[model samples]
Target: MPYQKLTAKELLALGNAAPEVNDSSWCVTWDPSEEGSAAERLVLDTLPPVLDFHTSGSTGPSRCWRRTRETAWLEAGMLAEFVGAGTPHAPGAVVAFAPPLHVYGALATFLVPARLGVPVWYRKEYVGALPETGQRRALVVATPWIFSLLLRHLDWVRSFEHLTVLYSSAMLPSDAGTLLEQAGPGRVTLVELLGSTETGGIAVRRWEGGESPVWTLFPDVTRVDGDAPGDEGAVPLVIRSPRLGHRPGEPQPAEWHTGDLVEPLDDRTFRLVGRIGRLVKVNGRRVNLDETEHRLRARLHCADLALVPVSDPMIGEHVDFYVVPALDTRADELDLSPVLALLGARPRRVHVVPAISRSALGKLRPQQTP
Candidate 1:
């Protein structure tokens, strides 16, 4: 069967007009709280009850999951309310650069408007000059990479007037956040949503002027017990949320242990510290880069170092240890022969650099081989 794409205006029209009686492979059962939209009512009356979404696989292998229409409706409603849609202060329309196939884009472009009656627009991909819409405000759904590119190309001050950006998939670089704030001041705001395909939106954080880094849990999501200390003072967090999706016939687990390590800031907020597991599988052997880095630092008595894992087709993931020698010690005087022999061919590459760029929060920025 051919794919049927629905636009925001057309979806609204479907809600207002008579829906076709023909049965679809898909069906919808809208949430009870979703109101004021003819299309939303039509979804409750007619549509597929379930849909399958594929994970982006940024952290690991991608998997397919099924979600009920009600879950989608509820999540969309929550997100719309969070972004202040449907009110006088709401954005003129939603503009998503991500493809709707991904969960993040689906929620931003499809589900959110389905609940709040917001008009929507889309881009083919995260590239090219953004078309100027005369609207005073726009809700932009994008990722960190796109933001970086936008910062390079666009006129920051004039372009971002009254714009709200939802950034996810990866952490936003601190410099980009700072530049955005400087460019637009109060007119532009960046919201970082911590979520995944399996769990939906769990928490959100924003860049405040000189505030500490922390993420606030969504009202429905709660932290579970059994969090234990992992390597390097990293404490893993478990979560229980209604938005969590489960496979068919599998009993819902008490909680999902998200591999993320976080430090509690208060009853409701937390700062992400690191990951519980940094072990990468390489050629039937496990390589713990964190441990290796620790050992290297202990032996070398140097603190300015980072071990970045880059994916390889043959080895799964290999380490690239970046070192910044002490001011007195020349890079030529440094020796890693012992470290290499201990690892037994774990790292595929190593480099000595003058300095390493880090985010404002003191986290290493993502690096690519130069």
Candidate 2:
């Protein structure tokens, strides 16, 4: 369905007119408003404190998560306060290129504007281009892929005189960040948010050329070292955030152990190493999936690729490559010798596909091999 975009003033008017809900399912609709009809507001305001959000499952299995509405609103309020500071007095519209149903988009794009009383717009599909919001300022809520797409059409991006882009779901490569700043002579600011379905906005870092590749934790969130062993003897990162949710019957955890291994630069900043889950034994040696992918990326011409591990009785686990080749290139014809040399072992196999499957955020999804 085509997403509906409306100004904040228009949405507020609709909500003021009639916010009534009669549906027992708690889902309400607004036929003609981005904020939804009064009925939708009623549902939102009256529903239980709990909200169900599903993970993108980019790394593994997709799981349904339940979080308190309070947590969501708190994050929204924080986003508004943070983004509002740099916005013009008129308040620029929030432009999101992500699915509103997703957690990141829901909080940052939708709820943030709602908190700020600002107009917001959502792009329902990948258009590979951004509309020119003349004169007025804009806060772009998008994923890495959207920014990657924007890089291709930097000329169009210059149209926006003032813009701040929020990138999430995956890490924005340093090179990509460079291209963004170089793109469009106009003013552009990049804010990278690091979090997941389990943890709300944990930390954020503003990307500038030559700055340390470390993330600064949000004031409300704190991190501590953990004993959990991760890939390459890395330690898991433990976090305590008010925005995190707790399951029923379980005591509130003092700290949440993020399976991600990080290098602590100090009390407030850290560098993400990789996910421990990606660690696998190949030829009886530990191999980090992220490291392998990085090595392969340096050697390959493809822009999008994923390295998945498959069980092997002999080697314990064997790597498989799934890649999306450039238009003029053939994925099958690509040499595997470099990849083999990187792993110091041969992959179980390599598959050339039309494109690497991923969520809107450029996070690789688990592929089903034929």
Candidate 3:
């Protein structure tokens, strides 16, 4: 059936405030007004909070995480306040190297900028391609690796008056973050976000002179130690945040158990220690699944691959590589020997497939072997 048995009220709940039959399919009609783009505003407003963003697969295997629009907006507000971006009078713009589809990228690039009514520029090559910020507040969205790489071109933007460099995807390397040169003509603050796709914004750390050890929670978020610390004396953090990505009409837990291991601190703060749950022993040695996968990705220059830890009673565990070889590259032609040699472990077997399926955020999706 082209149309479901639903009333106009039901259609309204489904985002059609005014449902009309153009010919065969139902279409939403909006009242024409100059207050805003009525159609765009209505669409964005009526959207249900339920959405699936994929985890970064850093601490564990990749999975599709259901995030909410409410969470996004809440975090955007928090970010706005943190970056001192409420005033629309200031000339401002956003420049990003991160993909907007990911949670971090979406917040830093689109959501925050859109709220502040500032222009956004996405550059595939950001080394020397930043637009000049003439007395305007500018936010630079980047990953740790890219931020480190961008250090070489610091002098390129010496004229920027106000710049905030926000980076995610792991902590910035100590050497790269040890000092912030004062050559630039502005307060070059550095901000780092610590959170997961499942739980929106957890805590944030900001440093201006140099890297700071203190990580502060958002004004509304709170965290506590889990019931008990798990392996390696790693403490699990339980948090309550108004910015968590949650679905409506579902029974919700009063507090959320974040999978990342953290050190116990006061209510409004905590230090991220490490990741647990996904660590496995291979060849009687500890191996991090995320680290192994990332190392191999950089080594092979391939993004579509995963490492699966299979159990063997005697050997503890072993890795199996599932990869989607690059175009025109044969399965047997790819090499993992040189990389594995440094790791002191090897995959029991490698699976060559036609594709490495991923979600919008580059999280790995399940693949079947032919």
Q: What local distance difference test score does each model get?
A: 0.62, 0.64, 0.58
TM-score of each: 0.66, 0.77, 0.61
With a 3 Å backbone cut-off (N, CA, C), the pairs that clash in candidate 3 are: none
How many Å off is the CA of 247 in candidate 1?
2.3
lDDT by residue for model 3 (138-240), tens: 7777664455445655654445566777766643543234325643424477777777776777788877764356778777878766888865665787788
Residue 336 of model 2 has an lDDT of 69
lDDT of 3 at 105: 66
Q: How would the candidate models be sorted by TM-score, starting from the highest?
A: 2, 1, 3
Clashes of each: 8, 5, 0
The TM-score of predicted model 1 comes to 0.66
Worst 10 residues of 2 by lDDT: 20-29
Q: Positional deviation of 114 in candidate 1, in angstroms? A: 3.0
Q: Give stretches of model 1 more than 4 Å off.
A: 1-6, 9-37, 45-47, 86-89, 156-160, 231-234, 278-318, 321-370
Model 2, range 1-370, lDDT digits (tens) per residue? 3344444433333331132210110111123333324423533565446766677887678776667766776686666655654446223566666555567866765566666444555554556345544435667787766765667666655666656777777645544555556764436667778788777788887654445456889889988779666655456889998777655545546778877788788889888876766777778777778767766776878756777878877656788877777777776667667777877787787777776777756676776452
Q: Give the TM-score of candidate 3.
A: 0.61
Per-residue CA lDDT of model 1 for 181-216, tens digit only, reads 665557666677887777888888765445645899
Candidate with better TM-score, 1 vs 3? 1
In model 3, which runs have C-alpha deviations exceeding 4 angstroms?
1-72, 84-91, 96-106, 114-117, 122-137, 143-162, 168-190, 207-215, 265-268, 292-306, 322-338, 351-356, 366-370
